[model samples]
Every structure is written in structure tokens, then in C-alpha cells.
Target: MAETSETSAAAGDAGAEGTEDTGIDPAIFSQLLPFDPFDPAFHADPYAVYRKIREQGPVTRTPLGLVVVPGHAGVSAVLRDNRFGWGDGATVAEHFSEAPDGTTVRPFIFMDPPDHTRIRGLVGQAFSARRVDALRARAGELVTELIDKAVAAADGGPVDLIDAVAHPLPAILLGELIGVPPEKHERFRALSTDIAHGLDPSLFLTPEEVTRRDSARAELYEYFGRLAEERRAAPAGDLISELVTAEDTDGGLTGHELVVTLTLLLSAGFALTVNLIGNGMYALLQHPGQLAWLREHPEDVPAAVEEMLRYDPPGQMISRVALADAEVEGVPVAAGEQVMLMIGAASRDPEVYEDPDALVLSRPAGRNLGFGLGVHFCVGAPIARLAAQVAVAKLAALDLELETATPPRAPYIITRGLRELPVRLTAAD
Candidate 1:
């Protein structure tokens, strides 16, 4: 998740208010003294702050008690290295305590080394290309079904694509893939979205929002825990079944691990895929030439989808705590210190791509950290990519038109996507 804190100087909400910027690098302070995420200005256009941060060299120490790495080279380097990690079980348990139920639930991704290896291997099988591919036929069916509804709703009148399709497609697809029945989809979507916001609560949310996150965490565990019971009662060959019933080298997963893994599968990937489709469509519409090119060359939709991931990923930031003292790209980081890797900024860094900001559909996009890197790389990446590839190609094939100069942007710091992306079908136009 993208880190949010120390609203810009414009908002005057700096580094938890009363705290001084005694440790912030002078260079970053001069350019972004108060990088205000709380300010309306930042959410509307966070890239501006990121650009400024990126310009201040590879890594800038922040007064927020973490170093911000915005440059492409540094961000990518940190992600690929193992010295930095997010699987500190102690930290995770501390976080869970704030929730009403206060239970420690460690997802496989949060496990390091041998633990990660065991869980990933089992979970990996469920997401292997072959396993994920089996779902594509259904995914395509859902896309077509959603597009049909979108077309009918638009009737040449503008409609929010997210409302009509983007959000539902993945919400439904993930529900089915994870063994969630159609009846549970609405509740699943709501719980997943709220729990995802818990990733970096203090970094970007208001007090009430943080409270909502805490509540969501407890509810999410309960919701998924029930599903685990169902999967155990009757095996259905679902991902949940695989997780609940399968055994790893280190015996079968603990019960806590099972519930937490389900939670991760349900919440972690749900919201982001919504954004992926939203961000992809927005990018296509913003660049008409590219949009037109995509419509004509639908065969190359996968490449276009890749470009979208590189251009403006849904999940924008990754945080890691140093396991031991380590230097990233020559910048010193002490043990236990946190580093925020700006996924969005690095994707746009000029050092990484020639004309990085421009969305060239055919560019060799290389390995974008949109899905993260190394151990914690997103497990659902293949599924998310396939969703964009197929759904985007379908939308392009439909020739939907952008209905406004700017769609409503999702007003959050760490996440970027539209609140509502208004579009109209060609028949409506």
C-alpha cells in the first residue's frame, strides 16, 4: 500500500503535527517541507509530490520515521533485495491488537524464509498458470456479462464504468475463485475493501477511518473463518479447499494460517484488481491516440495491459522494515528502520524508462514493481494481469467513449483509481 503522512506544507499538517522535522533531509524539506497527503490537493494529484520527491535524489529521509525511496533504481533495488522485510510477526500482532477481537492472523505472505517457502509453494499451486487459466473462461463470461449490462445502462448516456462493471467483475471473479458463493459477494466486497485500508492506517487515514479499519479487520477474520469451515466440511477443489485441505513440507498449515491466508486472498487482491481495471481504462481514455490504437490492434491487448500496470498501478507503495542494518543503493538504513518504496514514482522515473511518463503501448515495459518483487511479490499477479488483459480487450472492442474531461478520482493517498469513471457505449454515443 502507498504510505501517507505529513500532509504537504500547504495543508500545514506535517509529521504528526507537533513533531519537528529535525531528521528530515534538507533537500526534501525545501521541495516538499510538508508533503501533505491530508490536503485535497495531494489526493487529486499525488504524482506531483512524488515527482518532487523523486527529484531529490534516490532516497530522502523523512521526518515520519521512515525513508522514502522514489527514484526508480533505488525503489527497484530495495524490492528485489531480501534484507528488507514486512513479515515481522510481532509488529503484525501489535497491529491486530487494536482491532476489537485482537487476534493475530498471519497470512503466508507475512511469513519469512521456511514458512514463506512452505505456504507459497502450496498457494502457488492454486495460482499456477494452469489453475488460474481454468478460471479465464469464467472470467471472460463475467466480462461479457458485465459489458452487456454496461452497454444497456449507458444507452449513450454516461455511466460510471466502475459502478457498471469494473468493481463487480473482479469482486465476482475473486469470490468464485476463492470459493465464495454468489450470495456472499456483496459482503465479501465490502469487507475486503475496508480491511485493505488497514494496511497503512496511520499513514493516510483520519481517526474515524482508522477505527473503521480496526472494525473491518475483526469482521474480515470472522467472515473468512466461516468460509474455511465450509471448505473443510466438503472439499470443492477451490483455492480455499486447497489451502484448507492441503499439507505442506512443514505439516499442514496451522488453523490461524488457514484463516489468515483466506483473508489475504479475499481482501488483498480484491480492491487492487478493481483499481487495475479502473486505472487501465482511465489510462486508455486519457491518451486517445493510444486508445484508438488499442481499439484497432486488439490482438496486442496484453502488452497494453502491461503498459497500464507500469504506467499507473493500483497498489502504489510498498513498505519494508530492515531485518538488520542495511544500505539500499548506498543509502544507509538502520535495523528496524522502515523504507517506503514508491511503486508509482519508480514506474515513472526517467532513469528506468525512456519517456517513462508517456504511455507507449508497445514499449518494453521490463519488470515493473507494480506487483512488488522478491519474496512478497503478489501471488495473484497472474490472475490480476489476466483480468485486465481480457476485460480491457473487451472494453476496447466495445469502443466505449470517455464522457468527461476528468472522472471522479478516488480520494486517498496510497491508492489511486477513479471514484467513478464515466463512460458511454458507442450505441449511446
Candidate 2:
């Protein structure tokens, strides 16, 4: 990787032979600088803003020293490139905090290889494709049960889909897999929401937000720590118990690692999947033609799920730090510089797919940075796909008549989804 001069004279000229300038308009970057992505206004309709950034080109450098990769190729490259490090705490300090404790919250998903490899290796077996498939039938049964309940309660009136279906489907499935008691699901949901909401720096005071997050983390750690202990004493059929007893001949996970893995799975699992269901459903309702097509051909559900991920991903952006001087799409980045990959924009880039904005299930499956790429790709992706597939399939099967209780957008930049989607349902003839 090489550094290049940032000047108009050098901008148009190709700096490196193999690398091409992303040719992003500098003005677009200036526009988004003042607008916080987590603002309610932005979330209400981020696609308009995303369109402006994507049209400008693939990459732009923000005033905040963060490079925003908007198009498919540029975003994909950053995600796949190993020169970028995911777990650099120094970048967190630069962007969000300066506290020592902030540096100590080591999420395994943030680590580079060897460290990442070791941790992922320990937990990968549990999320393997076969294991995920084995659970799909049971997952579908849960989805059917929930939808039946929703229909029963509708009574020709609007039903809050988030509460009745979208939220609970994944929550219940994940709870069962992790061995969380049914009664504790509500607590887990609240805690996860608190932790996610606290991620936006503009929303809360640094100290207050940090404290809230740390407290939530502590509660999770304590709860899972106890669960791990119980599992160790008397193993069960659930994931936590299996993890407790797992060994590699050399040795098993330490208490700390076990707890962190549980924390990662529990926190990352349901929230994103819930958003996937919510976002996917909202997209379908907006495009009634697609909704009808799905109803006519339920077999297309899997492709519909993929389209949802590409059109409006559950995650909007992911961050990484440069491990060394790197030239990405002609932008000069030094070691420790933070890069923000705009997944929402990238998924809609015309370069990667035709008519990127329109929801076309017939479109051939294309590469997407939705689950990310490289070593740090989402570990729970299999379970997420299964959960979303089941939820969407069941929902499409219903004769749905949707109504917005309160406009369907959540105020968050990191995760893209609806806060609520109320709908009136009737059984299909």
C-alpha cells in the first residue's frame, strides 16, 4: 500500500497503475458532515441521502478523518482487504472516546487474524451451516405459530407487527438456542436495545452513554457467567452448555473467553435478525407487486431474502483501521486512520447490479458486502438467514394489509431498520 498526495492537480491523474481513483465528488462529503445519521429525519428516508453519496463515486474522505466507501467495488475492497485491522482500539478512542475502559471492551469480531482465527475457531462449529439447517424446521414451526397468533388477534384491526411477529420470532429462536428462559426474553430485548442505542455518540453524553453501555455489558456478562457455570456443572442440550464442555485436546476456553463469546452471540444475534425481518417486510409492503409475486411463488422466498439484504441491509456501516500506510481507490490513508464502509450505499451501486434501486427478485444473485467480507464476516450469518427466511415466508403467506402506526423508520446509523410496522391482516382466500 502507498500514500498519495491529496490535491486537485494529482486527483484526476491516475496515481497508481492497478488502482483507480474512486472519483467521488468532494461536495457530497461536505453535505453529510453536519447531518447525524442517527437523527430521526435521516432514518425516515436514508435512501435519498444514500443515493447522493453513491452517485458521487465509490469513496469519499469525511472531515472527521474517516473514509466513507459508498459504492460496491470500493466498499467490497475495504471489507476484503487484510491490510485493514478490525480490532484497533486506538481508532475507537479517536472517534468516540479517550477513556481507558473503552479500550478494554475487546470484542472478538474486531480482532485481526490469529486472534480472530482462534476465537472464531472455538465458536464456529456451533454456527456451521449444517447446524443452522438442522434448526430450520423448528424455526419455521415457530414462525407459523407466531403468524397464527397474529392473525387470531388481528380481528380485522391493525396489529403491531414488530411486537406480534418480527421481534419475537428471532428472540424466541435465539432464546431457545442459548437456553435463555422464556420469561427472561423481555429483559434481554431491553438490554440489547439500550446497548445499541448507546452506540451513537450524538445521542448521549459520553460518560452517561459509556456508563449505560458498560452496565448493560456487565449485566450480560454476569448473567452469561452464571449460565456458563451451571452448564459446566451439569451440561444440557443448549449451545451454552455445549460451549462449556467443548475442548480442543490442548485445552478448553477460559471462563473469560466463554463469557465473551456468549456476550457476542447474544448481543449480535437477535437484534440484527429482528431488523432483517422488519426491514424486509417493510420493503415488501412498499412494493406490492413484489409482495404479490412472493405470495404467488412462495419458493422465491430465499431470493427475496437476499434482495432484502442488498436493498436495505440491517447494518448500514462497519468500521476498520488501517494497519499501515494504504492507498485505497487513490485515497491516501495512514496507519491508524479509521475507515467507514457504507454498506447501504454499496449494496445499491449500479456498477455491481442492474437497476440497483428497484426490488427485482428475478435479478441474478450478485456479490454483496451485506454480511461483510474477509476474516471478520458476521459469524451468525447462517442463523440470521434461516430466521429471516422463515419469518418472511410465513408473513408473505398471510393476506396482509399493512398500516403505519408511526412511520416505519428507526433512528440509528449503524443499524438500518424500522422501529415499528403496524399492519392489519386477514386470512388469504
CA lDDT scores, all candidates in order: 0.71, 0.69
TM-score of each: 0.86, 0.85
How many residue pairs clash per model? 9, 1
lDDT of 2 by residue, 1-429 (tens): 001112111111111220223434434323434234324456666777888877766667666555677777777777678888754454343122112233344456656787777777778755667767778999989887877787787777787778787788777777777778779988887777665544433212245545676677778878888988988898877888877876665567777777777776766666678888888888888889999888888888888899999888888777777888887787777887767777787888877889888988667889867788877778888888899998898888777766863445655456766667888787576
* Residue pairs in clash, model 2: 87-110
Residue 92 displacement in candidate 1 (angstroms): 4.7
The runs of at least 3 residues in candidate 2 whose Cα sits more than 4 Å from the true structure, single-residue gaps closed, are 1-41, 93-105, 201-212
Give the Cα error of residue 304 in candidate 2, in Å: 0.7
Global local distance difference test of model 1: 0.71
Tens digit of per-residue lDDT, candidate 1, span 1-429: 323233211111223431232333324433443265545667666777788988887888766566788877887788777787754554444233222255555566556676678888777866768878888888888888877777776676776888877888878888888888889889877777776655552433445546777677677666667777887898888888888877765677666676667667766687788889999998888888998898778888988988998898887776667888888779799987767788888888887789887899988858778888887788998889888888888777766778886787755445667779888776322
Task: Point out the worst 10-residue segment of candidate 1 by lDDT.
Answer: 6-15
